[model samples]
Target: MTNVVTCFLRHRTAVLLGRRSDAVGTYTGRWAGISGYVEGDPADAERDARREVREETGRTDATLVRAGDPVDIEDDGREWTVHPFLFEVDSREVTPNEEIAVHEWVSPPAIRERETVPGLWAVYAAVAPTVETVASDDTHGAAWISVRALEVLRDRAAVADDEAAVASVARALRDARPSMAAVANRVNRVMSGGDRTPGTVRDRAAAAAEAALDADDAAAATAAERCGVSVVTLSQSGTVRAALDRARPAVLIGESRPAREGTDVAASLADAELDVTLTTEAALPAELAARAPDSVLVGADAVLADGSVVNKVGTRGLALAAAREDVPVYVVAAAAKVRPDEAVHGETGDTAALYDGAAPVSVANPIFDRTPADLVTGVVTERGVLDTEGIRAVAAEHRERAEWDGGLEGAGTVSG
Candidate 1:
């Protein structure tokens, strides 16, 4: 199979190249992008890209920008698909990875003169304009301008016109708001319910439902139409699961382990005629990786104050792998997933014990695992896709709101 290469170029320059190792391959000793094979596991791609980048440049702090489509190339009878990505880093800090015999930052004109690998040049040409636009915008004293550049590339590649694209972006933004809000409300309800507060389970469920439906039918329909892929959710939390279901993606439920709560989700989703995949946790990563899914939708058991997330143990590996691969990973839990008290206590737990009755064997199980905020591309709540800072702000807001409402009286507390 042709490997997928993440072509990392200098932010505004032509492309970054690295000398290949002595191993046999196309363009050996010639410069190449940060490349790797597309693994059956979605996490492999992301991991490979990061590894390659570090390997090629010896920099750990590089922030990668998602570039456009994959470009196909063939060398010595072996074909490869190159996925272009851009990153801006302090050039002074670059150190060549051991595999790299040499490195150079070549300009577009210089790129033309080199015995550049075939297919790669075209890919670079396609993405060069976008990178240049971003660079120019940055030089002109513009506010953070990466997204606008991405918008440009997205527009150029789009088959639809401006209006369609705008509408699509609008609908996604619109749907995300209420979905996140529903998540927040559900969490609040659960916390409140545990304390025997005024709200009942039905009330919380209703609040969640309302958040899911806040957008008009037309907007919701548009979003569903625009999103190209189906997302199966594996969560036991009702409010969260329901919120995800109402988002209109084709969702399937895996029988959640231990309690087998996923059975309930599967039955419900099946009744709705949604294509459901019922499987155990061990099978989830392989299943998802095999499908080469667009994204993975799951909930968090807890999110630390520092923005690290704690979800089910199985979820951590799945998420890390997904993040490693180029696939976008989203944690669709509500603001309630944020554990306000985690700061006072360090966050660490045994996750192996969630399974039933193997008491004779020592099983250390903690209900959650920490997922660094960076690993998460976005947090989809009834509110929307919140960045790391946005998530922190929202979590703080919820804490304040809960305290003001006397909503924290009897809640269980755990320190991070």
Candidate 2:
């Protein structure tokens, strides 16, 4: 029997299972999702999730919705840990495989009662939802909902008055117009696509913030004026650039190597009237340690649930330096940047370019580094300033409503 790994796959209404072929060995008749080991790849978790869906069910059109924590199990005296990934597939396309002798499309409770494998059972429980299924199909649809509409519905449901539902609908209608406008503008920017290199993501983000202000000048100006300095080890986002213009705080921009995104940040800050200082990546620690600014803000490419931050190569060191100096480091991020998919990826950049072709250069230029939760004092959102715990709370709230209201549709509702 070949050594085989097993995973239980689930969709909105049913769990997938497979009966192993006799030649495959262990648990020849046992049902399971597609599972295999790919050695030496750190992206195993993502790869496994995709592979399982395609191999077992012939559903290659699914995207990973989330990756849960790992579960350890022992079978036949061998111990293995399975990393479960929650995926949304078209329920309509599900068909039993030849290896799957008999399949069941049971509700969550029924699956819990019948699943035989301990590891697969645990994964099912973790991903199961309590709410009734709203829609089901052979293929899973994209999880898209306007943030504003969801908020209005939730708010109405929370109230205890006859007018609650009416208020909610009214508010949703009022907000939806602007929300759609914002999305349209962003879509236009992408469609027009002029100089949209990788560097332009930041530029686009900043431009969006600036454009948001046209609807309400006072609020936009206020957001633009919030006092916070981004001690960026790389380039600042268009959003951050707009904020700096209004806030006008001193910036400590670091010359992050190869990319030199910091040069871009410094130049932008200078253009915005913020007192800008350029320094080497290594100098960030000393510069922040020397004095306390109103706050040290940085942009994140991605963020983990435990509040670890992933940014440019030198971010972790800079965050550490800030922590030691009693300085608060705030991470500026959009909801889209929050990656609850898997363990934070720490690798950031090409090592060769990071070292500038130096001899004996074995440099690690992770495009994103992890900033532990303790070091991050707060998060600045279009909504407002949130401390570490507060950020988690807000995120939790978002997660709870993610399915029904959609993720961060009323994100602008929190805007200054």
Top-lDDT candidate index:
1
The backbone clash count of each candidate, in order, is: 26, 25
> Residue-wise lDDT of candidate 2 within 142-202, one digit each (tens)?
1121221222232222232443343344334323332122222222332233433322422
RMSD of candidate 2 to the truth, in angstroms, is 19.2
249, model 1: CA deviation in Å?
4.5
> 1-416 in candidate 1: lDDT tens per residue?
56575656463322477667666354676656666556555445656677767766777777665566667777788877776666666454577656666677654334445665666556665555443454333111011232233233333323234433433432332222121222232334333334322223223333333333332222223223323366645645434444444654565445655556677777767776666677777777667666666666666555555666665446666676666666676665455445443432222233454545656666554434456777776665545556667767866765654442353333233432
Residue 379 lDDT in candidate 1: 64
Scored by Cα lDDT, where does model 1 land? 0.51
Q: Deviation in angstroms for 68 in model 1?
A: 58
List candidate 2 stretches off by more than 4 Å: 1-234, 354-362, 387-416
Q: In candidate 1, what residue range of length 10 has the lowest lDDT sum?
A: 138-147
Superposed model 1: Cα runs more than 4 Å off: 1-227, 243-253, 341-360, 402-416
TM-score of each: 0.41, 0.41
